[model samples]
Structures are given as structure tokens and as C-alpha cells.
Target: MYQLAPNIDLLFTEAGDAPDRVRAAAAAGFNAVEMWGPTGKDIPALKEALEETGVQLTAQLAEPRMQFMIPPKDHAPFYTGLDAGVEVAQQLGCSRIVVGSGTGFGGRKRQDQLDELIEIFTRGVAHIEGSGITLVLEPVNIRVDHPGALLDRTSEAVYVAKGVNSPNFGILYDLYHSTVEGEDVAAELANAGDLVKYVQVADAPGRGEPGSGSIDWPARFADLRNSGYTGPIGLEYYPTIDSAKSVRRIQELVAGR
Candidate 1:
């Protein structure tokens, strides 16, 4: 079955509750939903929603929002959060979680910071290697969305994943960010190949629905499939129109249902 990962936080504003987002995605033909840190999630309610709506939690990002690709002085707290996220992932019946890099522009040497980041993620992989959950590091575009973010290039992200050197670690290649960063999506994705665990997208000009912006989504998605990415394609963009309208349009554009 084809899996579409809906961003509940961005999808069902009309429904108002987190569970309602899951219901909306399920009703709209999506089999999975991905969420940010488990901050406001109610486990029982989420479980009920999943059972009732038949939608699975495909992924959830870890909390506290520190840089994993650039080491900070207090990485233990971040590690603890990853450990907790693993337990949460186990609860949600998911085997993946996003590991975010911190804010842009640290007053430190680039190579030194990069080394520290590798060490932190290496330790993080060790902590969760026994578990089935995989930690995916995202490389945000410093040019448009985030300025001075450490992990910008696809090559750099691949390096980090290889440096971590565990099945539990990988990278998320978000198409919108890659477009903004001027990386050839097809080529970069082809290079990443099976190392990429998740993919997120939005239109280029407006960062809205896939077909409404400047991105040649059809070709890109074809490349994605051809490159052997069989995982859920994450609709992580902010809504340009009303949530329902935008989602419906995206469904027509991407899912053809």
C-alpha cells in the first residue's frame, strides 16, 4: 500500500484537536501521520484516534530543539530527549523519529562544531541502537528557511549519517528546502538513495501546495520513486488556502484520489 504522511499540526485546523487531524487524514486516504515533538500529545487519545480512524503514527520528532549536527556544551539533555523519544516511538508503533539540528550561527569554528555534532549523534545512535527506532537528521536550508544552520548540503548530511554509522541513524531530504538551497533535487536524492528515510515537500515559490508553486513536482516525484524511496511522502507544507481546500488540492495533485 502507498503511505502518505500527513502533518496533523498543519492539516486539520478546522477539526481543532490533534486526534481530529488523524481522522481527517484517514478520511482523506492517508494511512499515516507525522508529528513534531510529543509535547502536547495525549497517549490515550492518540491511541484511541489511531484505533478508531485506522491511521498510524509514522514518525515524531524529538523534543527541546537542540543542534545534533553541531555539538553544544550540554548535549546530555538532548540525548535524554532522544531516549525518551525512543520510548514514545515504541508506544506509537513507529520505528522512526526526526532529530533536528539547532539554530543557525554559533560562535564556534565550523570544523570543530561539525566534529562535536558527529560525536553527539554517534552517542545517540549507541543509546538507541538496540531499539528498532531510527533517528533521522534533517538538513535545513540556511538560505531561505533557516540562516546559518550547520547541515545544509546533501553531501554534508550524508557524511554525518555515514559518520554515525548505524542502522538507527539516517537523514531526511526535504525537497522544498533543497530547492531553496539550489541543490538539484533529483541528483541529490539519487545520491542519497536508500540512506534517506523521510521526504518532505512544499511548492517552491509559495511553499504551499505541491503543484501551485514553482517546483516541477511531477518530475521530482518520479525521480523519488525511481530512486527506490518507497516510504511515506510527507505533506509537511503550511496551508496556502483553507486547510481542507489546500489538502484536497494536494490530494488531487499527489494522490489522484
Candidate 2:
């Protein structure tokens, strides 16, 4: 059973107030909402609105400033950003935070970059330990969405999660990006089942709703369910049509499945 959670930022233009978006999501039959730039807004008031509306905030995009997986050291400020992000996540009752693994540059040894990611996550996760929020390292699609994202492979992300070896850290398996990154979704799921804490989806060609693109979402969704992914299937995509309508369409598709 897939639970739908809308990314408010996708409805960027039409949506005026963040609090109103929460209420709108609830009205549109969404119990949970995810926001990307909560830190840029008034966090205290945002928390109050979420509380009053009784809308659950599931996950958020971590501030992408440092090259987490890409090398070159000097990540003191990056770690500080994670610290601030974790505090906000705790306050919003959000369990997972999605972090981008910097950019991959030409000539940087792959092994050295991977080591840097592991080191950075290890330190960041330690600070957020027992805070009840887990840090999720997101492997973006270098081919399309990110072009040069450092952590492009699910296997690499899984390796980094394991290297951290803390319950406070995990990987968010976003299928759209995985497909773009050339990963066989089923195989990645099988290999990284234990380390994957959340799953998100869109599609390749359009990066819109699931069924609109070439991805076999139902088949993948079934595989994910069978693989024990009982967490929220985040609708982290830009809507080709009305955001609310697109959500309903996806909900119907999931229901039919």
C-alpha cells in the first residue's frame, strides 16, 4: 500500500503560503506534506501552521552547500548546516532528511570521493543521534537531474550508509533518479534493502507523474512493497498538470494497483 505525500515546492507558483499549502494538501486528501526550503522561511511559524493543521511533514531536502561525496575537505560549515537542519527536522516531527552528495568533478579519484562522503555522513549522523531523525543520503541522477552529482549510484549510496554504520543514517531510494542513473531498480532494491529507509518516485522523460513516463512504476512499486518498503512513497516530482489533480491521478493509479 503506497501512501501519497505531496512535495509543496512542486506547486511552487500557485501555492502562496507554505501553511496554506499544508492545508491545501490536507484538503486534497494528503495526510503528509514535504517541503524543500523550510529553512529559508520562518521556521517557527511554519511549525505552528503544521501543528494547527495536523499535517505531518515526512521528509525535507537537506541544504546542498558542500560536496558531500566529492572530495576537497573543509566541511566544517557543511556539518554546521546539517546540525541546523536536524534541529528543524526534530521540531517538525520529520523522521528523514534528504541530503545531496555534492558534485562529481573531472579527475577526482572515485575512491577518495566515496571516502569523503562516508566521513562527512559519519560526523553528521553522530550529531543527530538519538534526535529520532535519520539522515538520508540521496543519489541524484547525474545524467539528467543533476548532471554532475557525486553520488550517482545506489550501490555507492548503500556503501556510504553502511560505512557510517549508524541507525541514524540511511538512503532514500528515488526511482526516477535511479532510472536516469542507469540502475536496475529491482537489483538495487535487493542489494540495498536493509539500508533504504524511504522511497520516492517520478519518471524519466518528463520528471512528472509516474504513469506519464516510460518507467514501469506499478511493477517497481510491487517490487518495492515485496522488498519490505512500507514507508511513504514520496511524490517528489513537478506536476505536468494541476499539482492537486496530478496527485489524485497518481492516487487512483496506486489504488488500482
Candidate 3:
């Protein structure tokens, strides 16, 4: 069965603080949770909460903000940010970090940009070679969420990962973004194969809780299973109702699958 990880950054808002939200997720019976970035969070306190609640931090942003992965001039800051992220991940026991391909560079050849991405991640894989962590490259949707974002397709992400050619580098296959881009989730997952290290989900049209939208959850779940992606599938959606209530159906659906 697929393990479910609630995105505390988007859920459990009534809980008041990051640590409190961690506790809230545990109270809601989730053993795993994820967030956006650790820069502003109280790492020590969050660590305490995780230990107390016995919850695992599954994944988080590689940097506090989006970092440009295309242009060679932007690599220095990206590396520094990734290093900092690794330190925080060590404290939180998180094994995966989400990374985005920043907006496309104006006037740059598409292949040139892709080459730069490959080179950057190649060096990145070496930087964190023995850190017991994997940097998960995420493709954002340009249509609704991130306009002009480079690497908005799963195929492109897979291509980058293949270029990196390291076990420590992988792609974060977010179902919501894939749906928004109008890509077939099953086919993408199949094509991506083992290069996908993490998965996130939200129903399309409204980015709301599962039942509030039209995504065929069971079929997607099947696709994930067939793809051999045995990682935590993050619940990264806004709650239309009570946060706990929003996840109930999804939890049941995942469990049944």
C-alpha cells in the first residue's frame, strides 16, 4: 500500500504553528508529513515534535525559495542553498528535497538551458553524494500555478534525471501539476519509471481535497504502483472543509488500494 504524507505547510492551519501542525498531523493518524522550506521553521522545536509524535518528515524544498537551475551564473547560490537545505534535512531526518527548474531564460536556446540543468545537477549529485539524501526535481505547471517555469513536463524532468545519472537525483512526480499540464499521468509515470523518487497530489480544477475534484484517484494509484514508486505520496492540497475531514476519503482510498 502507498504511504500518505500530509503537507503540513498547506494543511492543519488551525493548529497555530509548525510544531503544533506536526502534532496535529500525528493526531490525525499520519505517520509522515512534508513542508515547503525549513528556513523560517524552528528546526529544534520541529525535531522535538517529530520525535514526540513519532512522525517522519518525508520531503521539503531544497531551498527556501525557488533557485534558477538553468543559467550557469545562478549555480553558486543554488549550491549554497542546497547545502543549507541538506543541513536542515539532517536535523529533520528528511531524505528527499524538492527542487524546481526556475523560469526559462529569455533568448537562450532550449537545448542550451537543458544542458545547463544537466551540468548543474551533475555537480549537485556529487556534492551530496554520500549524504543519504536525494534531490527531487519537481516540474511545476505553467498554466495555473507557475507561469514560465522551466521543466514543466515530466518527460523533461526524466530527461534531466537521466542526464544526472546518479541514484541521488530523481524527479518529484506531482499529479496535480501533471493534470494541469493536461498530461496523462499513467503514461508519464510509466515513462519516468524509477527516476521518480517522490510523489505529491491535489485534485485539479480547484486544487482542493481529493473528493472535491474529478481526478480518478484509484486509477492514478494503480499507475503509481505499476511504476514501482514505493515512496510517500504527499497530500498537498487546500482543504475545502475541516483539514482532518478533507483527508479521510483519501486516506481510505489509499489504504484500500
* Among all candidates shown, the one with the greatest lDDT: 3
**Candidate 2 displacement at residue 85 in angstroms:** 1.0
Query: What lDDT score belongs to each candidate, Candidate 1 first?
Result: 0.78, 0.80, 0.89
Model 3, 1-257: lDDT tens per residue? 77788998899989978999999999999999999988778999999999999999999997745446433564677788888899889989999988888888877887788877888889987988788889999998999999988889999999999999988999999999999999999899999998999999999989999888999988888888888889898999998999999989998888863
Model 2, range 1-257, lDDT digits (tens) per residue?
56778887775337677777777787788888887856567677778878988888889877756764434557777777777887888888888888878887667788888887888789888877777888888888877677877888999999999999988889999989888877888899999987898888897788988767898767877778778888887888988887777887678777864
TM-score of 2: 0.93
Candidate 1 structure lDDT? 0.78
Candidate 1 residues 1-257, lDDT tens each? 24768788787767768888788778777778888778887877877888887787878888778854443356778878888888878877877888866754467776666666678788888887788988898888887778867778887788778878887788898888889889988789888878898888788866787767888766777778778888877778888777667766656656533
1 against 2, candidate with superior lDDT: 2
> Candidate 2 or 3, higher lDDT?
3
Distance from true position, residue 119, model 1, in Å? 1.3
In angstroms, the error of model 3 at 132 is 0.9
Better candidate by lDDT, 1 or 3: 3
TM-score of 1: 0.92
Q: List the residue pairs that clash in candidate 3.
A: none
